[model samples]
Target: MTLPLEEDSRPPYLQAAEVLRTEILVGDLAPGSRLPSARLLQARFGVSSSTVQNALRVL
Candidate 1:
């Protein structure tokens, strides 16, 4: 089986930030709720910690 692979349309940091921000805006993820740690985001996004932080910085 061939699994589909795709490249990110936006920057990694931007994508990560938007995901969390959207969750916050939609109430899917509430404020003051413990967010996934940098390590977690790092693993999830497969990006560097700085990249995850850049996204969070947007919030």
Candidate 2:
């Protein structure tokens, strides 16, 4: 699940959250499903743990 990070004014956390929210809305991520671990998310998104946490908060 490698998603390209867009170059825009939005913060990295918001961008990550948007990607995740889209997946949920599109049914790619089913309701009540377990989300990937923060470490995995950080590696996948090339972001820091804090960024992943912020993204999860947004979700």
Candidate 3:
């Protein structure tokens, strides 16, 4: 769940969303399971609170 953000043209939120989306698609995150807290995600991905929120919005 600790995925480092890659340095690229994509936005940080999009990158975070992509990781989460992959986890969901691959069954790493089962449906109906509660997602990690925003704070936890921020720490995991080294992103800000808003970035985490935006990522969740994408999902």
Candidate 4:
């Protein structure tokens, strides 16, 4: 069997963050509602905490 693939391949945390932020801007996510917790996104996108923080910093 092939070795396991490494994650963090494309900086998805940043990408995901941008997407979520845009969604909020376009009223997709909406405001006041609690944003997806880092753990949720980390699990969903297989991204690291720092990467997520970087993306949020942009928001």
Candidate 5:
């Protein structure tokens, strides 16, 4: 899937992880906030289940 960010060469999971990580680091995703479910993330990122899980694992 194509992401809004300009990173292209990375794996899907890594790409998703980088977006989430940046959001969290920049406080868009707060410390105590609950993240969306894996299924939701999968749908949102248009990626596979494994990719969503791998992205969550990066957090």
Candidate 6:
């Protein structure tokens, strides 16, 4: 899978966080929604497990 965010100055974690945050804000990912697994996020965003953790923590 490809990250929705790409080619920006922000770090990968921050980028991923923003993407997820946007989804939440727009109701695409509703409140109390279960996020994708860290492994899935890592695969989707091409980032490390720690990066996915950090992104999830941002929410």
Give the per-residue lDDT of model 6 (tens digit) for 1-59: 55645568787788899888988899998899798899888888888899899888887
Q: What is the C-alpha lDDT of each candidate?
A: 0.75, 0.88, 0.87, 0.67, 0.83, 0.84
TM-score of each: 0.74, 0.87, 0.87, 0.64, 0.82, 0.82
RMSD of 1: 4.4
Candidate 4, residues 1-59, lDDT tens digits: the string is 11122543545555776677777999978689888887776666566777667777777
User: Which residue window of length 10 is worst by lDDT in model 1?
Assistant: 1-10
How many residue pairs clash in all the candidates, one count each? 0, 0, 0, 0, 0, 0
Poorest 10 consecutive residues of model 4 by lDDT? 1-10
Clashing pairs in 2: none
Model 1, span 1-59: residue lDDT tens: 11111555677777777777887899988877988898887887777889878888987
Model 2, residue 11: C-alpha shift (Å): 0.4
Best-to-worst ranking by lDDT: 2, 3, 6, 5, 1, 4
Q: Find the 10 residues in a row with the least total lDDT in model 5.
A: 1-10
Clashing pairs in 6: none
In model 4, which runs have C-alpha deviations exceeding 4 angstroms?
1-13
Model 1: lDDT equals 0.75
Model 3 lDDT tens row, 1-59: 54444556688898899998998999999999999899999998988899999999998
lDDT, candidate 2, 1-59, per-residue tens: 54455655688899889989998999988999999899999999899999999999998
lDDT of 2 at 58: 90
